[model samples]
Target: MTKDQLKLRSLILTALFAAIIGIMAQLFIPLPLVPITGQTLAIGLAATILGSRYGTISVLLYLAIGAAGVPVFAEFSGGVSKLVGPTGGYLIGYIPTVFIMGLYLEKTSFTIKNAMIANTIGMIITLIFGTAWLKIAANLSWTAAFMTGFMPFIIVGLVKAFLASWIGILTRQRLISAKLLFPERLKEKDNKVA
Candidate 1:
């Protein structure tokens, strides 16, 4: 493909992943402070499949849409208010979480093992951001925040991480084989020492 064609494809895929994140956000088991949602899994999938640049772009687009009052957040909520709300930290944290996850895979290899590690790390990052913000935003003690915000999600987060890794690697490989995604060789070259 030409440069413009590649750029267009990346943009399209990025927007599609953003939409996927929004859709996944709706699949939540509600909690008092924060809901456990499929958003994290989608974020992982984006990173694993799209790599750092497009993956992070997808996350940024997702956040921008939520911040613009699009009702794309968990429980069908959205707006700048949601971004600054008690649970907003988790939402905001998605940016770094997806970026780092993608960067890890980009620097290493887009294998299931690497994706799992990256997703696990991403999960921890999200929880930390959420817990810290929960403490401040909800006026809860650190202990309370840990108990409520962090603890409840540990097992569930691990499950999601596993799912993201397994599914993401499989899908990425398929996409590359089908020429829908840029090949892994290209990704390696993109990260080669200069």
Candidate 2:
């Protein structure tokens, strides 16, 4: 394919991944303060596969879609109210997560081990934002916020982080090997015969 065509394809795929993250967010298991879900898994996966810039843009697009009154959020709900509500912190937390995960993935080699570590750190950062925001919004103590918004998600988040990282990195590696992306450096080492 031509270079311009390749860029267009990449843009389309990035947008599709963003939409996927938004859709996956619907699988929410409601909690007291912040509903827990595999949404972060999607975010991590986006970051790993798309790298930092595209991944972050995808998340921003997802947020924009939700903000524009699309019912794409958890429980098929969306509006400005949700964006500014008590759970808003968690929603906003997603932005930084994309940056954190994507930026880390950009700098590091893709591997199961690296993916796990990077995703773990990213998730922790997101949880910190989510829980802290919950604390302030709900007027709860730190302990209370942890119990409601952060504690319940600890085990599951860890598992999802690792799993998502693995899947995303693996898929991206395959895509690079297939020459789906233009720049050869985008591929993982094994795919480059040179």
Candidate 3:
């Protein structure tokens, strides 16, 4: 594929993943501090499939859409208020989460173990940002922030990370086989040690 083709294909995939994140955001159980959401699963899936650059772009696009007042956040919430609201940090946390996950998969061969490791690390980063943000945004104690934002979501996060690792890698493999995500999708930058 030409450079333009590669760029276009990546953009399309990025847009698709952004929509996936938006859709997944709606599938949630609302809570006072933070909603139980599938957004992270979708983020993991996007990172695994699109790799770091495009994955992060996809997440940025998702945030931009939500901040622009589109109803693409949890419980169909959107607008700049939502981005600055109590749960905003969790949303902000996705930046590093998707970037690191995709960067790891890009550098290493994709495997169940590697995928899980990437996703788990990503989740931890999200939790750190989210929990901290919960405390500041909601005016809660650290313990309250942890309990409301981190503790309750631990099991669910693990499950989502596992599911994302398994399903994302499999789906990416299939797409590669089908040629839609070939070439660029499997690219590893040539590194020469001097």
Q: Candidate 2 on 1-194: residue-level lDDT in tens? A: 77788888788877898789878988988865577776788888987777777778888888888889998778887887877877777778888887877676557666666678778988888888888888888899999988887888889889988788778767877887676644335535523221
Ranking by TM-score: 1, 3, 2
Error of 2 at 149 (Å): 1.4
How does residue 163 of candidate 1 score in lDDT? 92
The best candidate by TM-score is 1
Candidates' TM-scores?
A: 0.94, 0.90, 0.93
Stretches of candidate 2 off by over 4 Å are 182-184, 187-194
Candidate 2: clashing residue pairs, number:
0
Where's the lowest-lDDT run of ten residues in candidate 1?
185-194
- RMSD per model, one decimal: 3.5, 2.7, 4.1
The prediction achieving the highest lDDT against the true structure is 1
lDDT of 3 at 127: 92
- Candidate 3 residue spans exceeding 4 A from truth: 183-194
Q: Candidate 1 on 125-157: residue-level lDDT in tens?
A: 999999998898899999999999999999999
Q: Report the poorest 10 consecutive residues by lDDT, candidate 2.
A: 185-194
Clashing residue pairs in candidate 1 are none
